[model samples]
Target: MQSTVNYLWHTDDLLGQGATASVYKARNKKSGELVAVKVFNTASYLRPREVQGREFEVLRKLNHPNIVKLFAVEETGNSRQKVLVMEYCSSGSLLSVLESPEHSFGLPEEEFLVVLRCVAAGMNHLRENGIVHRDIKPGNIMRLVGGEGQSIYKLTDFGAARELDDDEQFVSVYGTEEYLHPDMYERAVLRKPQQKAFGVTVDLWSTGVTLYHAATGSLPFVPFGGPRRNKEIMYRIITEKPAGAIAGTQKRENGPLEWSYTLPITCQLSMGLQSQLVPILANILEVEQAKCWGFDQFFAETSDILQRVVVHVFSLSQVVLHHIYIHVHNTVAIFLEAVYEQTSVAPQHQEYLFEGHCSVLKPNLSAKHIAHTTASSPLILFSIANETPKGLAFRDPALDIPKFVPKVDLQADYNTAKGVLGAGYQALRLARALLAGQELTLRGLHWFLEVLQATCKRTLEVTRVALLFLSSSLGTERLSDMAEVRGTQELRRATELRTQLRALAEVLSRCSHNITEAQMSMGHLSSELAKNRDQVHEDRSIQQIQCCLDKMYVTYKQFRKSRMRPGLGYNEEQIHKLDKVNFSHLAKRLLKVFQEECVQKYQASLVTHGKRMREVHDTRNHLRQVGYSVATCSTKAQEAQENLSKILDQLSHQLLQDRAEGAEASLLPVTPYPIPAPTDLVLHMQELYEEMKLVAFDLQDNNRIIEGLNRVPSAPDV
Candidate 1:
C-alpha cells in the first residue's frame, strides 16, 4: 500500500448531504487517486451481493464520453459502509459552473454544443446498451477543466439508472423538477399506472432545456416560484415557450448591429452564427424529443466520412511507422528478385530505357527508374508473369477492374496493388421526368429507382469488401481507445453499431416507400434549371417551374392520404417527420430557379389549401388530450338538455298556473360570462397543433410549369 492519504475513501469526511446521498472528496491510497465518492445513507444493511453486483455489472459495460468513470466498489466492505471509487473530475458539477465567475452570466453557444455532445453521447451510450440514465441534469455533470484546453465533461451518478428488463413503472419520480417531461407527471397521476415507459428521448429533452438555459442565461420556463410539485413544473415546461423573439434578438455587440435582448457574458457572438445554428437547435428543442434524429445517425455519418476520406490505404499497417525511411533500403533485395531474377526483363532493357517492346504490366516508367514509396503513401508495385510476346498489346494493366484486386500482401517477391482510388466515377442519373423536363411519369420513376439501387448497392458491396479485409486483420480489438487516470471502461461499441445500422436501414426503407415523391421533388428541381443545347444556365425560377413540381408540392396531401400506412403510429405526423419528401436545403437551389422562369407562366399560386391541410394533418393530436379533458363539459351539456326535456312535461302544467301569478318577466340587467383563458393542457395542445401546421404548410407544387424568361429576376441574396 502507498503512504496513507490525509483523507481516506468514504471515511465520511463530513461534506453536506443531498436528497440521495452524502458527498466526500476522498483519497484511495491503494491506487493513489483522489475521487469524489457518494455514499447513500441506507437505513438497513440487506442484500449486499445484489447491490454490488448490479453496480459493477452496469458500470463495467458503460462506455460514454460524458458519464463519470467507475473505478472500484466496496458495497459490504470498509467497516460495512458501501463505497464507490470513481474518477475525480476536478472542476465539479455544472451547477458549480453556473455559480462560478467563468460563466459570467451564462454559457456560450459553442460551449453549449460541447456540453450537449458529451451528455448526448452518454445518453446515447446508455440507450444503445438498453439502459436508461434516469437522472440527468446540470448537477450530475462534472465539468473537468484542469490545465489549459484540458477538459472534458463527464455524466456522473448513475445510481438512478435502470436496465430495460427491470420493468419499473415510470411513476416513480426520480429527477430534478425543472427538467421532467410532462408525460412522466401524467403517468404519476394515472389511477391505473403504466410501466410502458418513454425511451431515451427523456434525457435528450432535459439536455435541450439545459442548453436553452445555457443560451438565454435563464430557465426556458422559470416557474412563478420555489420547490414545485410535478404538476405545476410539468405544466410550465410543457406550456411556456422559451422567452425570446421567434428566432432570437442576437447580434454583434461592437459591430454594426447590437443585441436587442440581454446577451450572455460567455456568448459575445453575432446574430449570423445564431442563424446558422437554428436548424439543429430547432430539432433539439422539439417538444417530443423522440422524433429528433437519435445519436446513432450522428455517429454513423461521422464514422462513414472518417473511414471513406483516407487518401491512401496500406495492407500491412503493422509496418513500423517511424523506422520507415531507414528501413526502406533493406527490402531492395526482395524487390529486385521480383523485378529481375524470377521475372521476364530483357537484357536489352538496360540498353534501351525507352524499350521497343512495351508491356502494359510493366511499370509505365522504364526499369532505369524505380517505383517510389513514402511514409504517407501506400506501396504500389506491378509486373507481368505472362511470357507471350504480344502480352503488352492485349492488356492495359492500368485498367484492371476493382473486383480483381487481391486481399493478400506478400513481403516482396510477387504482389498486386489492391483497393484502387476510384474517383470521378459516380453513376450520376436523373429521373426520366427530369430528363424530359415535364411532369413526373411512372416509367421515369422506375428508372430512377433502378439507378439509385445500383449506386447504393455498389457502394455498400465495395465497402463491405474493404471492411471484411480489415476485420480479418484487426480482429475487432478497437479502432482506438483513450486512457483515464483511474477508472474501469468497456467498449460499448457493439451496441452503438447495431443502433446505427438499424437507423440507416429505417431511413432507407422510408425513402424507398416514397421514392416517387422524392423523384417528383427532384423533377421540379430540374425544371427550375434553364436548359441550353449544351449546359444548364445557373439561374432559374422556383414559382414558375415544371408540372412535376406542381404535382409533388400541390398534390402532397393527396399523395400522403393515398400512401398513408397505419404502422407509423396512431398519428403519423407526431411519430414520423416523413409525410411528403423534402430535401429542404436542395429547395434553396430551386428557389434560385425562380429568377429564370417567367413568373406569369408558372408562378406557383399560393395554395391557401395548405391552411386547411394543416388542420387535417394535426386534428387527432391537436385535440386528443383536450378532448379527453373537456369531454366532461360536453357530457354535462348533453345531460342538462335531456333533463330539461324530462322536466318540460311537468313544467308546462306549472307554467299555466304561474301565468296567473305573473312574476316580473321583463328582466334583471344582463351580465356576460367572462371567458376563461385556456388551460396549460389546452395551450400545449395548441402549440403542438401549430407545429404540425407548419409542417403541413411546408408543401410545394412540384408540377409548376416554367417558361424561360427574357431576363432573370433577382433572388434574396442572403
Candidate 2:
C-alpha cells in the first residue's frame, strides 16, 4: 500500500485492533523514526462521529511528559479512512504488564508507585487543558521501559476524551461499569432526579480503581454470573459501604495483601506509611465526585509516604528495632546518625554491621566494613555498632541491669517505671523491664476478672431469691374452712358470681402468658442487637433499634386499648347477692344464728370460725388485686416482645445482607427465647384462679348461713 502521510505504513506490524480502529507500528520515511498509526473505520457507528477527529485535536493541544505526542493526521477521500500517527510505547500498555507471568498477581508497590505518578501527571495535564479522559482504564495506559526499574508511562487512547466547561457534569454513561461512579450510573441509566453531572472527579475515581488493580490483580467490585448478578453488583455499588466491599479479599502468598478499598496496606507496612497511604486511598475512592482528590492534592499528600524508606535496625546481641523516620539513604551517614541517636557510643569508636536487600543498597565492606548480605524479604536490618566489648567485663554484671520488682512500688519507683515504658526505650534493660511490667499488669487484670465474675454470680443469686419470694407469696393458703349457706336463693346467687369470677381469672391468666412470651422474645432480641451493633456502623444499628422501639410502642398502645374492654372492668350492677358478699352483715347474721342454736356449746368454736372467715375474705380480696396486676404486667410484656421481634428481624436482615464473617449460620430466622413475662403472669394468674376457685367453693357450701341470716328472702324483697 502507498504511504497515506509522511509516515510509511508497516502493515506487517499489526500492533492491535479495536472495533472502530486498527493500530500499527509505522516509521517516518524521512526521519526513519518509529511511531504508532491508528486508522479509524469511520463506517462503524459504534464510535461517536465527533471522536473521529476530536482525538487528534485534543492530542495536538496537550503537551506533557506522561502524555503521548501526536505527529500528524491524514485522511484519504476515496477510502474514507482517517489515520493519526502518534508516539510509540515500546513496552506496550500497563495491561500487558499486569497480565505478564512475572507480574500477574500485581506489580510491586515500588514499581506501581512509578506507574501511578506518571498516570496522575498525564491526567493532571489533561485537566489543565480542560479535557476529561472519559475512558481511563488499564488498556489506555502505555508504558515505556527504561534502565533499572525506571519506566515512563504515557496516557494513550484519546478517542473518548472530551473537553468540558468549568463546573460541568459529564452526563453520559460511557466508561467501563466497574470504573464508573455510582452517581454517573444513576444519572444515565437509573435516571435519578437531582443528580448533577459528573466532572474530573470521575477520572479520579477511575484512577483509584486503576491503582487498586495495579496493587492487586482484582477489581473492588466485579460483575459476576448472569443477569441477576449484574443487578446485585449495581445495587452493591449504590448502597453498600466501599470499605465493606473488600471484606472477602485475601492476601497473596508471596506479595502484599490485596490493596482493597477497606484496608489497602498490610500489617507489615510501617506506621508512617500506613498513616500516609490510608488517607490517600480514602480521598481517591470517596463515592462523592466533588470530594475526590485532585491531582495536586493526591501528589502532595502521597509524596512523602511513597518516597520514604524504612530502616530496620537490629542489635545482633539484642532485639530487632524498626526505625522509619530516617530519610537519608546512605548507610554510612545513617549508621553515624543512628549511633548518636540510638546508642551512647560515638560513630568512629563503634564498628557497625549493615545488610542490604537490593542491588542499589548493597553494603560495600571495603568502604566502611559493611557486609553484602542478601535478604529475600523487604525487611532491611542495620546492626548497632559495638565499641568496647572487653570494657563491659570490668563493670559489675548484676548492677548493669535493674532487677524486676516482684512487687511494684506504689510510689516513686512505679511512677518512674511507668514514665520510662510510656516514652519507650530501645535499651535491652528497658525492654526487659517493660515485659515484666506487662506481666504484672496482665496478672492484675486477671484478678479483676475473677472479682467481677464473683460479683455477677452473687447478683444472680440475689435476683433468684427475690423471684422465689414473690412467686411463693401468690400461692400461700389461708388456715380456714367455709361456713354453710342456709338459703337456696342465696346459694344460687353465690354460685353464679363464683362462676363469673373463675372465668375472669382464666382470661387474666392467659394475659400473663402472653406478656411473658413477649418479654422473652425481646430479651433475645436485645442480645442480637448487641452483637450486630459491634460488626456494623454504630449509626445503622442504633437507627434499627429505634425503629423496633417505635413498633413496640405502637403494639403497646393497641394492647392498652384492649385492656379497656368492658369484661375486664367491674360492674357494680352485675353483683346479685350483696348479703353474702357484704362481710359486715354476714358476720352479724351468722352470730345471731350461732346464739339461737346451742349458744353455749358453739360459743368457743364460733370465735375461731369468725376469725377464720375474716382471713378467707381478706385472701379473696388480695386475689382480685393479683389478677389486675397480672393483666397489666402481661400487657406491658407483650408490647416488649413485639419490639424485641422487630429488633431481631432488623439484626437478621443486616447479618444476611452484609454476609459478615462468622454470620453464615445466622441466615435462618431468629428464634426468640421463651419470655418470662407471660410465664410469670401465668404463675400469678394461676394462683389467683385457684384461690378464687376455693372462695367460690366455700361460698357454695355456706347455703345454710346465707338462708338463715336472710330468713325473709323468700317471703318478700327485704
Candidate whose TM-score is highest? 2
lDDT (0 to 1) per candidate:
0.38, 0.47
Pick the lDDT winner.
2
- 1-718 per-residue lDDT for model 1 (tens digits): 1112223654445433555466677776565567766565654234355543455567778876677787666543444556666778777777766543234235643465566566656766777787766667777788887467755778877765667532333434456656655566445432236565665556655665565555544454443342253344435345343423112221222222111223332242223234333334445445554455454654453233223211111111111111111122234333333334322343222111111111122233332233333323323111111121111011111232132112211211011111111100100001111222221111222223333333334323322332232223221221121111112122233223323333433433332334333344444533432232123223233223333243334333333343434333446443223322232222323333432242222112112112212322232122222222222222332233233223322333333444457631321122244322224323433443343233222211100100010011221111
Candidate 1, residue 108: Cα displacement in angstroms equals: 3.7
**Candidate 2, overall lDDT?**
0.47
Q: lDDT for model 1, on a 0 to 1 scale?
A: 0.38
Quote the lDDT for 185 in model 1.
Answer: 44
TM-score of each: 0.36, 0.43
- Across 455-535, the per-residue lDDT of candidate 2 in tens digits comes to 223322332332332333222121000002122343334334334334444544553444344334434543443443343
lDDT of 1 at 492: 35
